[model samples]
Target: MAKFALLIGVSEYQPGLNALPGAVQDIKAMQRVLQHSEMGDFADADMTVLENPPRHVMERAIENLFSNRQKDDLVLFYFSGHGIKDDSGKLYLSTSETSKYQSGELIQTTATAASLIHGMMERSRSRRQVIILDCCFSGAFAEGMKAKDDNTVDIKNQLGGEGRAVLTSSTATQYSFEQEGEDLSVYTRYIVEGIEKGAADTDNDGMISVDELHEYARKKVQEAAPAMKPEIYAVREGFKIKIAKAPVGDPQLEYRKEVEQCVRNGKVSVIGRRILKRRQSELGLSVEVAAQIENEVLEPYRQYQANLREYEEALAEALQHEGTLSQHTREELKRFQQLLQLRDEDIDLIEVPVAIEKDTIKQSEFLYQKSTETLIYKLRHQLVDITSTEIELAEQKEYKDEGLFERFTERAIEAIRLAQEETLRFGHNFIGTEQILLGLIREETGVAAQVLQLKGIKLADTRIEVEKIIGLGSGFVPPELPFTPNAKRVIELSLEEAKTLKHNYVSTGDLLLGCIRLEEGVAVRVLENLGVNLQNLREQVVHTINLSKNKNIQSQ
Candidate 1:
């Protein structure tokens, strides 16, 4: 008892772009196979042949697919045309008449490739869903494109139940091609042709699953163009394609269940709040508590401003007594002035007026200083003793040669950058500890050397150590893998662990404790040799963070 198919072909639009030629061919072939390709009860699909559909109509098509699928059924969604995103990565499906850049804010936003897959996978039924995106910029469209309807790109995590998969024409940045003589897209041509010939079942399992068809289409297209790479990403449980040709039957109840699960209603603001709620457990504070702490810091910051004004006044008075401030004081003042001069980047720090009154009342004193320019930089109200630029510059500067620890970090910065790049590519703003761990493992020198030496541990040797621990026949792949956590936490935990044993900065001891916290790496044995209890070390880090306000050396 195979289920029904939902095939939607989008080629024509009002927004200057014409409907694609191959779209009709693709739609026809898919329609033919879906009705009678295999073990279905021969049900005809309710087809939607849209040409330049309105925004709401396209969104409805996505909503319809997931909302109408069943456990044993296969739901197929196909798209063809031009797609693009703005600077913020919000995707837009052009109407034959729309502008790529200035799409109206009120326009109905379409589902991105990532959102399409993730949403459909949320279904509770055993039904498998397959989506083929045929358009320029269609590859990573679902994953990276923001949820325009929601006003944010941050999608929440919701694992799908069974049978779901996605097959797309190209990666997000690559442009898909259309056949020259025909109206259909080159991508659609191969897919439709493959279905007609029945080469989609690669494993010869008698029936074609979404995964099978996707892999076949991707391979088949390589001959058309050597440079074009098509990709298929399979998610959720297994599924099969049961295509049959008959008049439509009653829509399956299981698809209805899957569709019910895929409804992701609301905006990005709501999604962010949900993420914070889940993360609060690890912080040991409610969202309100974190906000409270932030508010508490403000009053003291204002007080610092008052102190800074007083210091500046006193310094001016002292300068008058001597006829000018000392060279060091002058240099410091000049530093603040320079900061004020180049601050267009952070406009919030434009408070302090450089023309403060002089302590000495000489006639020449007021007229001596000449023209000036204004600049902006973000400054802390509590840091009244220095300009905003100085505060930030101080924060950004690494302490060097302050014992061996400073020297160790000076050399490790580049290695850290490489790891940070990798994390950034995955779309995170900050490099977390897992990246730091990976960085250390990659370099194994300088700061990494210090990290390893604290507990007399070595990463290369530690892999052997891990083999030793699990060698006793507890064959579970160690969960909580290392070098995967956030970099800041890794540094914090590593530093704190080292400090317990009285090490000056991060050392091998820190590295071992890090691996131990991961609870599965061979690096854990080093902690055992150091006579450090894993429970005690973990508790110590908790205590340090709870008691201290800021552990991040590079504080925001």
Candidate 2:
């Protein structure tokens, strides 16, 4: 029986429609498989391809594809383009001339109606007919068919006949997606892959049936784009129609299937690696060959993750400049999405959470501001009153004088407050040792600041070094930020330093010693980066304390 095929791809469209450059590449890919000797085995002379055809040209080619065919002949028609629906939900296959008005109304005359294609299929003499559509709303071709409760069209009841099969890229209500940076559309890419790689041949049969081809493409399309649901419909005997040949018992194909089973979240588990190694030995495949196959299977997943990271980085950078995204920033981010070849759905998954966090931060800041204003007003008007519990606690603390916090002098307390301010200044949500170091340098009246200045370590230089070590934070900053474990350890160590000096109260000098003692803290890293000698700095602080003590004794 003669095999005839006509493939139509419309990459160019009128002003209103977005151009699909992948559509034309899709037709080329399909033609390669159909005319391949070991695949569809269709004669080159009988194969026809039309690229960016106008409405009339596309209509005529489709009509001629189904006309004057023998009953036993195999006839296939494929289209890759925009499939739009009117206000009444009538599906139309868009041609190069297809466009919409300013009101977003579909210009019916510019597109080819699906009804026309269905009519041509009904009048065809060939029983072995195949119709494949890769476009939005392609499943609408099964219109008037009995639909499932979920709105899925029953193609077998409506358009299926003996030896006839229909395949679509998406459901009746879904939009077929085209990935950016890809040469072919997502659905059509898998279709060609199934045929070229002979992966469509299930059950180890030497030939690939139309049913097998549809199932393979459907599974793969969902893997790359979960929202897309490819579909197939066929009547009795149509499911068994052979569309291509396969290399039976191919070891590479078997290995690929094994690799697919072992992969999760784009990685092979430790146990999965062992399983793959055993399979590789059994198949007599070299290690290099096995690794190459595994990489190929993991490529798409890796690309997806890489795209996510890129988008998140860009968003974080934008957030560093402002709490909320500005209109210009939003527009720039949209353009970045296209440049990254990411879909709107994919980016939404990343952006929505960050946006919510920003909103939360704004509310928290508002509350914090109001509370601060109230505190200032009370202090200014002398309206502040100490509660009985607070007074009792203070009396107990002064009597004991054992609590390390109570031992902190007013200057030391100011240093700690300065540390928290430093944390917020850097847009960080948590106070770390780096901020404590900066606080000691900023409290110029304290012994710690005096010693640092003597050693030529200025606050500005320390701030720069700290920034170099820990870049600006991109997340939300709450009203009360907690200190990191290392920062807390520094505070505890400061109390110990005060006791070592036989002092009744903790001083800013003690805080500096605490930071120096915690060698693993980021504060130490910043100090080292600033070319400070920790041992010398410690000695100078001790000597300065001694000089102050001697001066006090002389005055007495």
Instruction: Give me the runs in candidate 1 sitting further than 4 Å from their true place.
Output: 16-19, 37-42, 45-48, 92-126, 138-162, 236-556
Per-model C-alpha lDDT, please? Answer: 0.42, 0.74
Clashes of 1: 54
TM-score of 2: 0.58
Worst 10 residues of 1 by lDDT: 347-356
Q: On residues 346-410, what C-alpha lDDT tens digit does candidate 1 reach at each position?
A: 11121111111221123223322321111011112221222234334445784221222231222
TM-score of 1: 0.37
- Candidate 1 CA-lDDT value: 0.42
Estimate, for each residue in 1-556, the C-alpha lDDT of model 2 and write its tens digit. 8999999998888896667788899999999999999888989999999999999998999888899999988899898888776776556788989988899778999998777888898999988888888875532212111111112333444456677898888776554766556798878988998888787787777898989999989877766665567888888878887888888777888888788789887899899999999999999999999999898777767766776778878887788777667999888887666545466656655553343333334443443344434533432233112112322454677733235544565456667678877887898888899998998888765567767765678989998988898998876776556678898789778878878877656767788899999999999999899898999778766655554433331100
How many steric overlaps does candidate 2 have? 0
TM-score, one value per model: 0.37, 0.58
